[model samples]
Target: MGSEKQGFIWLSGLLFLNIFVLSTADVHYYEFSLQESPFTKLCSTKIILTLNGSFPGPEIRVRRGDTVFVNVHNQGNHAVSLKWEGVKGSIDGSNELIQPGRNFTYKIELKDEIGTLRWHATSAWAAATVHGAFVILPVATEDYPFPAPTSDQTIILGEWFREELTEANQTITPGSADAYTINGHPGETYGCSNDTTFEMQVDYEGLYLVGVINAVANETMVFDIENHRLTIVGQNGTYTNRSFTNSLTLAPGQVIDVLLLPNQNVGHYYITARSSSGTHITNGILRYTTTTTSF
Candidate 1:
């Protein structure tokens, strides 16, 4: 048997791909509501449209061959619909549009072999906050090609705009965002008033899996962890020929799975995401855990 525990993280609209081995197929039910909530970004706070009152919403997990039914309700004034990215089939062969004060049910089947994907509102600007991770696990008969890691985590890369996007004639052009964020925070380096940042703890000589999700609305971004090399394992829910690189490039709505083997000197390292065409940068911390440290 492999490691049974899984971890999830969200950035703007990014979703982590973490596959598990399951014994049987099952049906999963989920409720998603489109509404508004007060969110802080780039040193400012405002009410933004959201899914289930969260910026990045919730994580959906299922086994291969499982069926998932998501009931989405639009509480806001705008019409909304959700589209699953990297999915093999359509949304029951129909468009899933939920108007204001209306509800729609989305039926999706996990027919793909295995990988990470995401679900987001098809309506423009709604995806700015209405998105989440969709994870599909392999069947119990299958196992990962590589050795299972001791621990795992996810990193979601995204952008944040300071102005309201619901206004008329608003669009996400280049330079529309005030800053970028990792797991919904711009980190202390960006002068975020909240001073919140994403942190990953590791142990010496431990192998870990890091799922990277690029949910940036408009720009391709680069991801790197200081003093480490990432071994590419999968992309967009499909395993690929393994490779190694110091950094990764991801366009919007792309997901990559990488293996992190921490053999360097134990300390804190910066996990950075920088926009390829813009000056926006966000950061997280990767801290090595010692016997005396709890994080």
Candidate 2:
């Protein structure tokens, strides 16, 4: 009887291991190219190095335990290399530096990372523009530990310099920025000539999962939604001991996941990102849809 029980336990362990292994063995492929493109922010337009002509590049999404292959082609004038923010690179030495007009393939295994992370250039000043969100979703068969939100949104907060990025980096003194931006828009509230701003529409009583990325080059930022509380869910691809806060601080290259349960009265609220040093403050709008007529 003792021998039979031990054998049963071993078989059950093996079966569980097989299921876990199978859940994360998928492979994904992507291609990114660096090119010079005109990006306008803070009422000025300049040519900057971008991935595939996107200022914040493109989001790379995969399931946990999946393998990802990214072919990075450097068509711009500067050397480039990508460093996955929280992922381990291939064991076969796939991630290497790519010179101007050269290409290199990056292989990453999302062994255990699952949450909001990012990828950016390791070269100088390129990270200011050549970066994008990297999301490792939970396995299809697995459910979230908590109740899933109604929707998910990605918000990238970054600093903007009016001059050329490389030149600005060399000349920027302590505590300075031309503007702060949310999803590449330095919203109209900042007095910029352009009226571009990041806006999200929310239905009454719906919950939202917000993935916030602090991609600022220099200063730490505080994110807050006026008159609303946020529940901390995860950061850097890992779940955290859930907590609630009215505001949260994020340093450069940090990502945070928060759950926003809009229980306030139906109206518009300002979602603000302000630098800790008081150098800049930017605003976006959260508009709630209402069914009743205003008084």
Error of 1 at 234 (Å): 0.7
Local distance difference test, each candidate: 0.77, 0.81
Off by over 4 Å in 2: 1-21, 89-95, 167-174, 290-295
User: For model 2, how does the per-residue alpha-carbon lDDT over 142-261 read when each residue is reduced to its tens digit?
Assistant: 677667888888899977767787623533343566888888878876676665888888887788888899888677889999999999999988878789999989987789999998
Candidate 2 Cα RMSD after full superposition onto the native fold (Å): 3.9
- Where does the lowest 10-residue lDDT sum fall in candidate 2? 166-175
What does the lDDT read for residue 291 in candidate 2? Answer: 36
Task: Give a tens-digit lDDT track for model 1, residues 1-295.
Answer: 1232222223312322223322266789998888888887666788888888876778887777788998888898787778888888767634646779988888887765465777777755877777777777666565777767687776777667777878462457765777777877788667657757889899887888777888777788899999999999889888888999999999888999899987777689999999888577778898988534346
Total backbone collisions for each predicted model: 1, 0
Local distance difference test, candidate 1: 0.77
Give per-model CA RMSD. Answer: 9.0, 3.9
